[model samples]
Target: MSAPKPSKRPIRSYVIRSGRLTDSQRRALDEHWQDYVIDYEPSALDWNALYPQQQPLTVEIGFGMGDSLLAMASAQSDCNFLGIEVHRPGVGKLMHGAHQAELTNLKLMCHDAVEVLEHCFEKESIDRVLVFFPDPWHKKRHHKRRIIQPAFVSLISSKLKTGACLHLATDWQPYAEHMLEVLEQEPTLINHCGPGKFWDEPERPATKFEQRGKRLGHGVWDLLFRKE
Candidate 1:
């Protein structure tokens, strides 16, 4: 059964201004917002059933602090993006930024990406999936918490259309390598590891987290895999 919808007014409404969001981004969010502008509950979502008839959708799991999400919404007006994040501060920041920048091609939800994927989305519905800089959970014991394991790759592959892409970026070489290994080994996906992966990583506005990661000498690597 689908989960019931939450209250009309969001528990927290943030308005981002003079920060990472560009004027154009803010404007896009504003132009596209509507009643039920954002949804925080992921349990009730019926991803397989709720797609807008007019356009295909892309999803981003664990959209850390949401800079890339808003930027992508502005950069690509044709496709809608569903952003799933468990972090309240990040949600507030993204929504605030979206509200401030007037981003319309995006929606919000807070939940576990795994549960949502397994329960909510119907088979072969997603056009693309983006996971950028997810928490590495680097500890040996906590590695189970990492989201890029084989099972996830299998599930993600099942959900994506034949040619849909799964894109992930990480500054941690270890995580990047692990992800590359897993994605490469998966029979359902093929690597798109060309130089353009960096040059064409969906044009996004810069974020503070990225800036900090850069200053710390962390190099970012993007891995693209297409569902077979």
Candidate 2:
């Protein structure tokens, strides 16, 4: 008899860290989840049913601790926001904040962003996509695990509406260069700051992590690309 074949493990951009949840975070997850969280399903989401009013959609991937996302949602009442994160504590914190603020324009999903984008969102459905400080995967061998690859960028481009924007920020220069290269290679996306250049102005409010990085003397690179 032939030996059993080994099952292939999928390459993931992030490893699930065992971050302990505080009491409030746990309680928020248990109590307010249904109010602000969207369970992931392998089907396109009906935005009209999800939000009370029809508005432009902005999706933020990997919103660590959700501080920046919450700020944006609070500030941009005209736009609807969907945040994707795998961390339970972050999701809970965001939900807790959303509930306290009575934010009707925000929702969240706890799932792998790549799968969510592929399955739950329709093509040309997103008005804006934000990817801020994703895991750098700094090791050379782990570069393949970085989310800013050609295929991923192409997928993002397809999901964006015509003239819609993709904003990416990274503290790692190497990863920033990699992102710029990958995004530039996508034929459907045009760099909003011109070719081979980064955004000079701060387009969004700084996240807690970003502020901490800045305090540590880290330089940030921002890239803005639009779907053609």
Candidate 3:
């Protein structure tokens, strides 16, 4: 008999925490979902056909409630934006904001971002990827569940075009260090800052959560790596 096959580990970058939805959020999901939300699919996506014009694309993973994403989309009409989050309330909130802003360049997916990148995105198809304030999974035993491991970075690398940037920010110091280490080891990526260094605070609008953390004296670390 052959040696026992290894069991496949689940890819769990997030724990789905159910939050009660506001009436406005429910209204947004009911009314505006078709305009912005993309259901999860296993097939590759044709991004050019999705938007009105082929332009630089940015995908933000785990955008909490989407205040910053809305800001970016509003400020950058030349780029199309996609936001992936497992939280239904966040998705609905983003949709409401997008509709209120009359944004034509934003889309959303309520699913596992890792799965979306693996199955829906073609290699070298994305212009920029943003992962801001991902769950730190701070416990030693839970570190494996953090999203910035080598394999995940490799998969992210495959989805980015040459010279495209992967920007990550975290409020947790150890997790930031881990992100830096993993991103530095990716052969296909070149650090925007030199090895072992962190990037300066970027110009993107600050999210409410980030502002709250800042008020509490929490430090933020940013990492920018380019596909090379």
CA RMSD of all predictions: 9.0, 1.4, 2.4
Most TM-score-accurate candidate: 2
Where does candidate 3 stray beyond 4 Å? 1-9
For each candidate, the alpha-carbon lDDT, in order, equals 0.72, 0.93, 0.92
Off by over 4 Å in 1: 1-53, 194-207
Per-residue accuracy of model 2 over 17-78 as CA lDDT, tens digit each: 88999898999999998988899999998876899879999999999999999999999999
Better of 1 and 2 by TM-score: 2
Q: What is the TM-score of each candidate against the true structure?
A: 0.74, 0.96, 0.95
The per-residue C-alpha lDDT of model 3 at residue 34 equals: 86
Any residue pairs clashing in model 3, and if so which? none
Q: Which 10 residues in a row give candidate 1 its minimum summed lDDT?
A: 10-19
lDDT of 1 at 102: 62
Judge candidate 1 at residue 185 and give its lDDT: 84
Query: Model 3: per-residue lDDT, tens digit, 94-180?
Result: 899999999989999999998999999989999999999888987889998898899989999999999999999988899999999
User: Cα deviation in Å at residue 131, candidate 3?
Assistant: 0.2
Residue pairs of candidate 2 with colliding backbone atoms: none
